[model samples]
Target chain A: MAKREYSYYPGCSSQKGASSSNMMKSVATMCEELDVQLNEIPDWNCCSASIGYGSGGELPRLVMSARNIALSEEHNPDQDIVATCAACWLSTREAAERFEDDENMFKEANEALAEAGMKLTNKTPIRHMAEVLIEDIGYEEIGKGVKKPLEGVKIAGYVGCQTNRPFGIDGESYENPMYLDGLVDALGGDSIPTYEKKVQCCGGALAFSEPEKSQEMIKGIIEAAYDNDADMIATPCPLCQANVEIYQDQINAKYGTKFDMPVVYYSQLISVAYGRNANDAALNGQIIKARKLEEIAAK
Target chain B: MSTNTAMVEKYRNNFLKEVEANVEEGEWVKMCMQCGVCAGSCPLGNAWEHPPQEIFMMIRAGKREDVLTSDSMWMCTSCYNCIVRCPRELPITHIMHGLAHYAKRLGIQPKGNPTQWFSEVFWNNMMKKGRVNELKLGLSMYFKDGFVSGIKESLKNAKLGMNMQKTKRMAPMEFFGGHGVKNPGDLQKIIKKAQELEAARIEEHGK
Candidate 1:
């Protein structure tokens, strides 16, 4: 059988956010072991997520995402474009869907791509790395590679709004999705049960548009995790990581509550549990400021 | 001769009207039943003068100014508790957000709150770089917000953050790369959309 590979688009968040980049690095290592190749698409641009749409309408946003997709198409025919950023996944997935669904819109988008020396044919699927792992690779296979399991720790899995919302998967309601929880459970960690806010927006760019309000949203998530008695929170989106991590301290200060739990990328947790070095797994910059995991791993 | 309309129905405009023209999910607003479930589940409802349920009532009563000017808007955490628990699924959170934006535009600042420092620093960072630089942004927020006392405490743990940044344990700042819409035209294109939305909102409210 030919070696399986997918073109990876790191998107803005992964490129800029250290935690997100580390998660991608760990994911790349795991992918290597799993016989999966991640080809980084060159010259890819922004996904223009909620911020873009809120600021620039759908067409400009679609054109921006389509340009990135076009770059992926030039490199690979009929291969899915895997993304690590939730905003990228949402934007690219929406753009790909729109390009395929609307002929006129597709022509306009392709025309814009031509300016960037690219073209979109709707030939590839835009996928979140989490989707590729959970849906394509399967948790059982991932579990098989685990040299160290994350035992005795309670984890609150935050999927964020983009991954599960706008009704992406067929027959799966975004609100009550269990894909991340399944992966966490497969890794032998306790996936704490959570309700509605688990999938709410982490106030991504709203950190710019409305900072205090955004912090409030972050505080709410932290509070929920605390209420659930979770030791940490895990997520797949870089924006969510950045927002939740940055606001956690503020949240703690605002309410005079001690929420010193770590917020990590799901892949980082997996990489750590697989006996990877804490440095290798990028556990150092976690927002919640907990050293328990590192202490345990050191032992 | 008691005519039947819920208190929420009578006071609906308290919150709803403030959001009447601005809500992205307007369908949710009409479905609110004033069940108080939203306020009841709200984590910070105790801090608000008008909890989520009352805010919604105020909105529905066309009492837009009260909701917009009230400190209650700032107290909302945007946690979506009201949105989730409301049988009506009224976009309570959305309304609150819209009101906040509106209030900001009108210069209705929150009093004696450290959270305001976050807003100032965040926008200043974004306005300059067109994207957030976490390390600088965080420090700016802390310093500007008068959290200088917390700075030394936070710095004690700075080694971890610095190490992560150095060893690539965390995402690097260069990835965002100031690639924001730099061209004047592109920036305008982005700004115009927001302007249109704001204009439409104001027109709807007869402002």
Candidate 2:
């Protein structure tokens, strides 16, 4: 089979030693196994995130992403750009949308890009990894790759904000997306039927700025999963994983709540289920160790 | 634009008017109709000093001092929950960030908006390197206020940091050998050009 090639924009979060570096490795391995080729955008910069727009106006933020888009076109022409980071996905897609909606903005952004000796026609379709799995690679194919089906593990699919809203899966409900749940089911895990926190926000970058307030939000997301008897929490965004997983102990201490929730990425679960080792899934960063995932992988 | 002071202030509301005039995305706040979907859907709605709806009302009421000084402006996580749920399709997330930016520009940021401080540190790091080195960024954000506070905060997160290191999650070497892109000069040029263009655009409005 000729590998389906895509221009991959592994956001800053995937850099070495960053929180989701392991997720990057896992995505690479899973892609190889699934026969989907990821040609990374050469020397990609930060997406300027939501904060980018907040600090600078629409134009600078637009240029930041537009520069990347222009580079992707220059290097990987005709190939769709795929972002692994949720913030990267949102910012890039948001830029694309703005360019498409307004002709003046598109022309102005291009003029700004000309200063950098680049041009972007905004033709490339920016897609998240979750969307690729659902559309490009079918669930049945993913299920067949599962050497270790997560038979007994019950997962709460925490879609979070970035991946779910503004540009979520085409057919999925923004209020209550089920793509994660569907992926869980494909991996042979039981997904919680009414995970109320599935759509809840995990305070993303706020985990740093306002820890107390942000942890309260993280607490609700994890607690809801535990309350529903979920063994692990699966998410798409790196910030969501960092906020929800990294702060469990701190949150417990702060709020006097008994909680130990393991947060894993959707790709991590897929990587392990596809017969790759736990390390490939970057399972070590999981503060609340996923014993269930380990046991299944060991089998 | 009318130079009538009180009439313009009372009729248009200073806060909302400033937001509309200054913030590009903040123009959509006029679409908000006191509907509470943005507030109701937010995970930290109750925690906010002024939830989404109340913030809208406060702007319309011309509570400039209150709006800029409130913790509510700094508390938004940029989750887009409010944006996705707002029936009026008001871009609440952008407006919230815009308010924070406006407050920062006016030097009226509230006392303890650590997130706002964190965001500053993060943006500076990104601008310089075209990438974020977590370890360096973390230290700068926590310690940006002062070394004493940095030590206190680092001690608090020492265990988490240690565990992250052991797990190979935190990139330690990045602090010493930054992971900026190969062509840092090119990235810096792009950043500078964008910044210059943005400054020019703002000048067009500020005048």
Candidate 3:
């Protein structure tokens, strides 16, 4: 098989020791096995995440992403720009889409870009890492690389907000995206097909600002997972994985329920199923350990 | 004249028209059929004093101060739930943020809104080096109230912090100076120019 290479944008949360650093690690390992080469966009800036809209405002937010795309276009021209972070993908793609639809904004964005000796031609495609995995590399190809099939593990595929609504994986319903479940099944795990809260919001950046309200929303997500009798939850977005997994203890305390559900990234699960150890799968970083996946990795 | 009052005078009591003229994606606010799907679809709908639908109605009703000064828009998580679920296909998430931004621009946003506060902090931190220093961002959040409460917040999350370090998920080195763009000065210049351009555009739109 020919190697596939794309410019990679690892958002702030995935930086070392950051909130979702483990995701970066596991995704790197998974991509290696899948023969996808990710070339990091050199000296990239923030995409001015969803939380940034209030302070960053409209044009500044667009310009911030425009700079990164400008850099990517100059450095890795013609290659599609892929972001592992849902926010990065959404923000950058939104900028490009807006620029395409609005000519004046494009001209102004380019004017700003010229301040830094750059210009946004806006030619490259901005995509999420999941889109690359599902579309670029088919499930059959992904399944072929799984050395240790997760036979008995039942996964509630959580397709949290950004990656689902507005712009989701192609052909998947907004009410219930099945790509996560499809990936799980491909890896030989039993995906709960009727997981109703699959497209629920995990509170995103508000998890910090409004903890109680965010936790209330998160509580519903975890409760739905437990109700479906899933062993673990697998998700595509880093915020979803972090928000859902890190807050379980607090939720249990607040709600007076025993909620110890393990939330792992789809990449980590893929890495583990590809015969990588816990370290390779970045499983140790999980707040609530996926003991079942750990055991599988150990084997 | 204060921008808020000036805007009120300029619009001549039509708050919805003011929003349409100023806020990002605010034009879509008038398209809301009041189906209440946005209100029902919001994850924090119950917590919202005025859900998206009510907020739209308030704008149409010309409740200027109530709509701008209210904390409702700040409660948005930008989950895009309302956007996807809206029958009118309003970019509800952007509108929520736009309302918050517009309120802040007019100097009428609710005081001490945590989301607004953090957004500012995150933007400043990112602008410094063109990439967020996560460790510093975390510390800033923990210490936002004061040193004593910061210490308390640190201790409360000590276990989580230690777990992060043990798992090699966080780097203490990031506190001194983490990774950044090679030419942050260039990025800053671009941002400054962009801000100036946006201001000029808004001024033109106001007329």
- Computed on alpha carbons, the lDDT of every model, listed in order, comes to 0.62, 0.80, 0.89
Which ranges in model 2 have alpha carbons more than 4 Å from their true place? Answer: B1-18
The best candidate in terms of lDDT = 3
List ranges where model 3 is wrong by over 4 Å.
Answer: none
TM-score of 3: 0.97
- For lDDT, candidate 1 versus 3, the one ahead is 3
Task: Estimate, for each residue in A139-217, the C-alpha lDDT of model 3 and write its tens digit.
Answer: 9999998899999999999999898877988888888888899899999999998999898888888888788889998
Computed on C-alpha atoms, the DockQ of candidate 3 is: 0.78
lDDT of 3 by residue, B141-170 (tens): 889899999999998777767766776767
Can you give the lDDT of residue A112 in candidate 2? Answer: 72
Instruction: Candidate 1: list runs displaced more than 4 Å.
Output: A1-3, A16-19, A168-172, A194-197, A289-292, B1-207
DockQ: which candidate is best?
3
Give RMSD to native, each candidate: 8.1, 3.0, 1.5
Find the 10 residues in a row with the least total lDDT in model 2 chain A.
A50-59
Residue pairs in collision within model 3: A17-B169, A17-B170
lDDT (0-100) at residue B146 of candidate 3? 99
